[model samples]
Target: MGRIGVVTFPGSLDDRDAARAVRLAGGEPVRLWHGDDDLAGVDAVVLPGGFSYGDYLRAGAISRFAPLMGSVIDGARAGLPVLGICNGFQILCEAHLLAGAMVKNTDLTFLCRDQRLRVENTNTAWTCAFSPGAEITVPLKNQDGQFIADEATLDELEAEGRVVFRYLGNPNGSRHDIAGITNARGNVVGLMPHPEHAVEDGFGPGTDGLGLFTSALSGLLETA
Candidate 1:
């Protein structure tokens, strides 16, 4: 089975959930600590959602400098598959792994719901199992979820087909209704939705999020 690393930062709330998702997807989950510099030689890594460092300064602002993040950034640059959710998404932006930044919801409040999203690109390592333009439901809960980027960057992402997921109803005022994005190499992805929470049936929105974890495992097998 593919071994996936799940990094746990101080105040992280979803690392276990992410690990469970990996296990449910038929992969082994490796636990990684924020202060550790090693990645445990896992095939991929996940930065789960939470109020890392208490969301001080800014969401993910503090966690971005954690020792583990240094390795994550480097590994991601070298083609490692990385999935960041919610606060983890903010961390990816803070670390410059992906473009765009997240701000508070347009309504200036924490919102929680089963969100509908359309998969825009399936070329990424974490999304290869999804069909093009597929719509899926996942749990989304966050205080700062609106995604913002300059027009040029937005256009570039669109032109390159890097926008991974788009919200159906534009829940948080994100530009272009963007719910997720991937790096230029399509190995690293960051999204505001909590896909881990939806990976198990009889728990969340549905099992719609399992494809992401399974996709990564499939990609590893193909390249192995």
Candidate 2:
């Protein structure tokens, strides 16, 4: 089975849920420490959400330099699968594995809602289980979930079909309604929603988030 590593930062709120989701999707969940420098041979990595370092300099500014993140950066660039949720997404950008930065919500307040999103692209390892154009509901909660990019990066991302998911209701005021995005090669994905929190049937936003884990696993198998 694929070994999926879930990193836990000091204030990480969703690492357990992310591990459970990986187990439910039939993958091994390996717990990784933010201070540790190794990934323990995991096939994929997931950076779970929370106010890492209490969101000091920026949401992800501090966590971006965690010891394990260096290995993650190398692995992701080598085409290993990686997924970032909420604050994790912020970290990916801070780490430069993904483009752009997250800003405060357009309303200038933390927002929480059962957000609807469209899977605009399913070619990424993290979203391959979902169908293109599929509509799914997941919970969104954060103070700085807005995504912004320079015009040129935005155009390049659009032209390359790297925009993987878009919000249906335009929550958080993300450009092009983008809720999630993938790297050019589709091995790394970062998004502003909490898919791990929505994986369980009654405990979450329903099982809508399971597809993310499952889809990623399936995509890996299909290619191998």
**lDDT winner:** 1
lDDT (Cα atoms) of all candidates against the true structure: 0.96, 0.90
Clashing pairs in 2: 129-215
User: Model 2, 179: alpha-carbon shift in Å?
Assistant: 0.7
> In model 2, what lDDT does residue 216 have?
75
TM-score of each candidate structure, all chains considered together: 0.99, 0.97
lDDT of 2 by residue, 1-224 (tens): 78899999978999998999999998889999999999999888999999999999999999999999999999998999999999999999999999888999999999988998899888788887787899998899999999999999999889999998899889788988888898888899998988887887888679889998997778667766
RMSD over all Cα atoms, model 1: 0.5
Backbone clash count, each prediction separately? 0, 1
List pairs with backbone clashes in candidate 1. Answer: none
